[model samples]
Target: MASQYSDGTLPSGNIGRDFYIPGLTPVGGEDEGTAFDMHARQTRFNFSSNTTLSNGKALKATIELDFMATPNGDERVSNSYSPRMRIATIEYDGWLFGQTWSTFQDVSVLPETLDFIGATDGTIFVRQAMVRYSAGGLSVALENPETTVTPFGGGGRIVADDNGVPDLVLRYTLKQDWGHISAATLIRQLAYDDGNAIDSTETAAALSVSAKVNLGRNDVRMMFNTGAGMGRYLGINAANGAVLNASGELESIDSSGGLIAYRHLWSEQWRSTLSYSWFSADNDTALTGMGVTESTRSVRVNAIYSPSKELSFGVEYAHAQRDVENGLEGDMDRLQFSAKYAF
Candidate 1:
């Protein structure tokens, strides 16, 4: 179970939006008032199996699901729930095939918080279908491809025309007795063809570096990511990967973001984390539109108590701000409480 109270304007997805860009402020209107909500949608379930192959190897498969999807806005009356797929993967030898965390992301370096992803605005948060190979802390993958584009006039978005190419990602990690470090790179092709003589294509690329250091009972985690046209890959799709210029040509956006978190243990069963994240994008207002998001930032602090490994309780406070290219800005502050039990 969880309860959340938010003050000020926030984007869709409620608390989940805290990690992404804030929604634009209403024209000539003040930000929204305080809002409160509660639910038990974070409960999840998992299934897994392992089989031994004839060649003395092992094959593993797993499927995980959670009830986080809200349909038709009937949370109070229907208490509606939908099964959301979190992970479905198969692994054999050093190869992974199916949907899982993106090759560009390092979950080990993520901060601990009640919110889904602590550093929403700065982290590479993505999960999709891919074929990956791993060997000695090095991994490479070819992931599913889809391009998001802001139209020339910029009222809505358009899907890029199919370009028979998948995203390419490479990552390497170094683990030491004191800490660990990782670096990754991604490249993809963004294309669009309206079929009415408007056709365009652009190449996009991104880089990420992450690290975690141990200090007795405390630790530190951090990540930095930057790219051109890294749209849906970073910042939870806060900006388009590509947008049409005034001449109807495709162009990628430049963005950079990073996060730092520190964890402290007050006792054997009580601990806390303090984290900060920020993201900024260079949007060509004359080409994309004035409504494009310019920047977003957030701060989070949380404490958790675990009587046992199966049950835990936590409380968190988060503050976030967003700015648009047109100079309009909005901010949000939220308090969240959660209790969970694992079987």
Candidate 2:
């Protein structure tokens, strides 16, 4: 997607993290001017194959890639593109192993939009190495683990620490003719060893529920998620999962988020979706560093036209608000357009 910003600078870092709005303005003589950008980094390639095992079991594998590298700070000369891996997985019988979407997320209920993630600020979005087993409408997984933490002082930046155990997740789905409902639970072990004889560890957990209802030619989708120390998993890591207190102990933060969306059909070739998302974190000012994000919300509307099953075009408008723990707030507006073709 190509986007133009009117009020504030676009968020930096990982593309997924960029989906969240920033709560603080540019400081230290930094630029806060309007910006325009156009790119086709969303284009991707997919390779898949299926086979039958000697034991009469089915086997499948897939690999996906795209060009969304950071440009290495040289956007003026070479716009050099690089291939990045998005998914690589193998399935045998009812088991899956490798890297793909998190088992805690329900991709089927996500809203459609021009941006990479339509309701990212409130959505459960992540991809990591994992081993999962499925039966009927229930699934379980053990995923890679990492913990993020903030120092006791208010000026230090957040840092990630290695984990001692993997994350565990359980999910179940109920399907009917009119709609479907899904629920998931997650448990994690967070650990930190600063090599300064000040080591700490903590346990975190979260819950998520989602639903989609079909109304003839239209539909409604919704999701709600809440947890303690669910940092990088929800809201694209807008807040640290845990913080170091004055005594150098680990303390988990409280967070909640959700999104609601509706899709309407204008004709056989045209359709539109309207979505709104909200996310909030409760951080202790004395424990967490200052200037941390307190809350974020966004609204987006888009229209898409598909002349053929293989080609489509879309345009979207979005507005977002960010609030900081120190009472500072910022606003952002964006216009995005995209064209996609699949083979």
Candidate 3:
């Protein structure tokens, strides 16, 4: 496999929280994490070509390989290898196998943002071991979830759980002279079956409608999406008590949210995006005595500029607050900026 860092492409970074520049290839392929905080990050290369086999039948193959850096900044060969075959089964009729985005995600409606956190939460399942079929712009997918987690501050035994199981999705799309429109629904099961013995079976669903509008010199696009789900987990713990940084000590919670965005291309040399999102989790009824109920809400706005097709930059401001009833601490805030170049 050959690695090409420059191709004016953005590899998918929906697997984790990492803003990606549209001009640069993803630091790694979409299969791994791109966040700087992760203990490991991967970079991949791909080489695909076609050849004629036995009976004049043309056969095609793609070789993909990824490189990873350890937390200690060490690179090892033992940790890297060629990607397995079967990411797709039959390419005909839009049938897919191995790994790919779920039908539930309507990426066309998403805005271009430099903040990794700004991408839809649905992108995380882009490629998984699964099978799917599509026809007449309608697609259905069944695949396992790609779970991820990070140790906050790297000291406590407890961690934020982004774990989920293989989910089922159904999607429909309509294409027009200007652009396209899409909608989807989904259901998933969570992996964590602990804490208060609450239900680990989670159901996630989303709805969205968007379109591209052309107005002579300027082109505009917009999207609106909302989703809801449940899982046994903790997003925020209050600073009220002498908290033991141990697992099974925190309360689990449920959450729901929505996102909206707008993009305008002023000209060939200038463009930008404005986006807003809010998320809130329900308090744990079982942990009523634990002194805290978990919930959170946040909103953000961003402006992205593309000086040229090869270079891009962005700035963003966000305000977020998390509240836990009778719990450890109150709330916090976040602000971010980013830039990238594509070869």
Candidate 4:
């Protein structure tokens, strides 16, 4: 996808941590205005294989990569970039092992858009190493664990990788002829230890519900999530999972996010999608400071045309806004174009 960010200088960086300049993201500078970029950094590919066993069981495996989350390259000479791992997994007999999409996320409800992640600010979007078990519609997983925290009275993020227990998730999906719905639960630990001013651990939990409902040749998608210490998994780390108090203790932040989209098939070769996403954090100003983000939202619309199943072209328009606890607000507008072909 090629993108043109306007009305603001959306400086490029790790879209996940920096949030595609969405929620809880700090303004880069005072003169944030229009800028442009045209690239294929979003390109991705994957390889899959299936093997059958003598006992009639089948093993499936896949490995995928994309040019995101890696170190950025200069655009002057070569514009070279590194490929980041997206997924590497193997499944057999209702068991999955390796790094893949988090069990807490419902990928089926995501809308098709030119941006890397259509509902980033309001969706459970995570990929991590795990061991999962599935039977029928129920699934359980033990995923990697880490926590992000903000220093007392406002400071940059501190990724406290000090957890011994993995994050646990339980999900159930109900499928019907018309569509499917999923509900998931996440239980995690938030820990930090600076050895000087901070050393604490806390437990947190969250829940997410998502659905895709069919409407003849069209469909509607939605998701809603609420919890404490799940910010990193939700809005792409728009807000830290917890904040440090005066006593150097971890306090999980309460937050919520949602996404809704509608897709309509204009014809066999034409389709369009409109989507909106939102995120909010309930933070104590005394602990987290008034400069932190309080809320964020975005709306986007796109049209895609595919002459064949393997080839497609698309364009999208998006507007995003964020509000700080101190009452400051910022908004950005963007336009993107994309083309894709697969073999």
RMSD of each: 2.6, 2.6, 11.1, 2.2
Tens-digit lDDT string for candidate 3 (1-343): 1112211122333222232211112222233221222322333355666667678665554545433322233224343333343233324335665544345545565556655435332121243456678789888888665322112222222332334556677778888777676766656543333365422333444454555555554445544433443221111111111121235232223344445566667668666666654434453334333333344444556666778887877666654443434443322223456566655
Q: In terms of lDDT, which candidate is strongest? A: 4
Q: Report, for every candidate in turn, its global Cα lDDT versus the true structure.
A: 0.82, 0.81, 0.43, 0.85
lDDT by residue (tens digit), candidate 4, 94-117? 999999999999999988887888
lDDT of 1 by residue, 1-343 (tens): 1222233433344544322233332222354655566767777999999999899999999999987664424555686777889889999999999999999999998899988677788888888999999999999999999888998857877867566799999999999988999999999998888888668889989999999999997999999999898888878777889988877789998989999999999998999999999889888888778877889888989999999988889999888777877877766677888898989
> After superposing candidate 2, which stretches have Cα over 4 Å from the reference?
1-8, 11-32, 71-73
Best by TM-score: 4
Clash counts for all predictions: 0, 0, 16, 2
Candidate 4: 10-residue stretch with minimal lDDT: 1-10
Off by over 4 Å in 4: 1-8, 12-19, 24-32
Q: In model 1, where do residues sit more than 4 Å from their true spots?
A: 1-28, 70-73
Report the Cα lDDT for residue 107, model 2: 92
